[model samples]
Target: MAHHWYRNTTSGNSLQESLDELTQSQQITPQLALQALLQFDKAVNSLLAQRVRNRVNFRQSYGSLTTYRIGDNVWTFVPNDVEFSKVTALIKVDKVKIAACDDENTGSNAKE
Candidate 1:
């Protein structure tokens, strides 16, 4: 089974909660709710792939990497005392987490 990464995000979680409520209220069947969530995943992934065009790159400096992990082609980094620099802004923070996923294994079901 492919991992539906978006389902763990805030919006996805909200949708799932709403579906659960609908299922509990007998407004929708369990199977239909499941299908709806699956479609949500597909639609969101497809839209992001097609609509999002601009890419921003940033470098983190003056930071110490507190934690690093790699699993399922996903790279996670947690840094402390970091300064992130973009094109026009520089932001400093005490800590931040960054997650990166490889495109081929993003588990998106969108077919071009």
Candidate 2:
């Protein structure tokens, strides 16, 4: 439950909008709404970790590693002449950015 990437995006916006409505109607206090949203974030993180089964692997061949970065335990790579494959399908691109995160390092179980 460490990363709430969707909290500021589409999925989280709906909950925030609903909370705003409830707050304006006086059915829930602002503090309560905030707590609810925070709980929603945690719930979403756990649910995705536990329920999502889809996975994709990419294999790339590049002339040289253009750039690489590691921050917050996530690795980002920008390579030139990249090719990505999932199963038997292959895609080629001039330049691509790849970002990877290890769930174990983040204290989450992505395969559970």
Candidate 3:
């Protein structure tokens, strides 16, 4: 969805600039200049295809899901009670720091 400018390698100027130069000098017709610009764009796009392929391979090798720590004041939805007028329980969880996990002591199924 992004537009890019194609430059002519001979003069190191954009296709638009080349067209303007030709028009000013009356060297080539406007229709021929337009055709040359289109051909230059096609050649540039063909060269860009290889670079895009490399980027796809790079993304596939390194892309991964990242985990983030949940904040203590995270919100949770609770259903409203039928009989109670105001029914909302906002539980505040306390953060606890624990040492390394042990199979028997920590009640974890981790193998030694």
Candidate 4:
């Protein structure tokens, strides 16, 4: 499935929930739970960074940025921009999907 804006944060929340469950169940000490949650957060951030790299790389195959599924919206990401590292965290601003997909010089006139 394609990655969305809420995935990593949801994952972090789930991690904390699991830690709470473990601590309440007496399976782990509170101190250990805290350490585990911190470790999990670090790992998630690293994984998210790798995912961002993969998305940037995969974006090269498609010459035109006319692919998205949130109400049939389209997104265009600028490759090699340091700002793009935060792609997964930012809200979708490119929501215009034109009828024509064969041309790269099309206008983003459609709005959801």
How does candidate 3 score on lDDT? 0.42
Candidate 4 local lDDT, 8-68, one digit each (tens): 5777678778888999999999999888866764565466447754332122332445453
Q: After superposition, how far is residue 90 of candidate 1 from its true place, in Å?
A: 2.6
Better of 2 and 4 by TM-score: 2
- How far residue 86's Cα lies from its native spot in candidate 2, in Å, is 1.4
In model 2, the clashing pairs are none
lDDT of each: 0.75, 0.73, 0.42, 0.47
Question: TM-score, each model?
Answer: 0.61, 0.61, 0.37, 0.37
Those runs of model 3 whose alpha carbons end farther than 4 Å from true positions after fitting are 5-12, 56-112
Candidate 2, 15-109: lDDT as tens digits = 89999999999999999998998788678768876988766555557477899987765667888887767676778888878766557436543
User: Which ranges of candidate 1 are over 4 A from the true structure?
Assistant: 1-14, 70-74, 101-112
Model 1: how far residue 8 lies from native, Å:
6.5
lDDT of 1 by residue, 2-100 (tens): 446788899999999999999999999999998998789779878887997754544567668899987776678888887756668777889888876
* Clashes per candidate (backbone, < 3 Å): 0, 0, 0, 0
* CA RMSD (A), model 1: 4.9
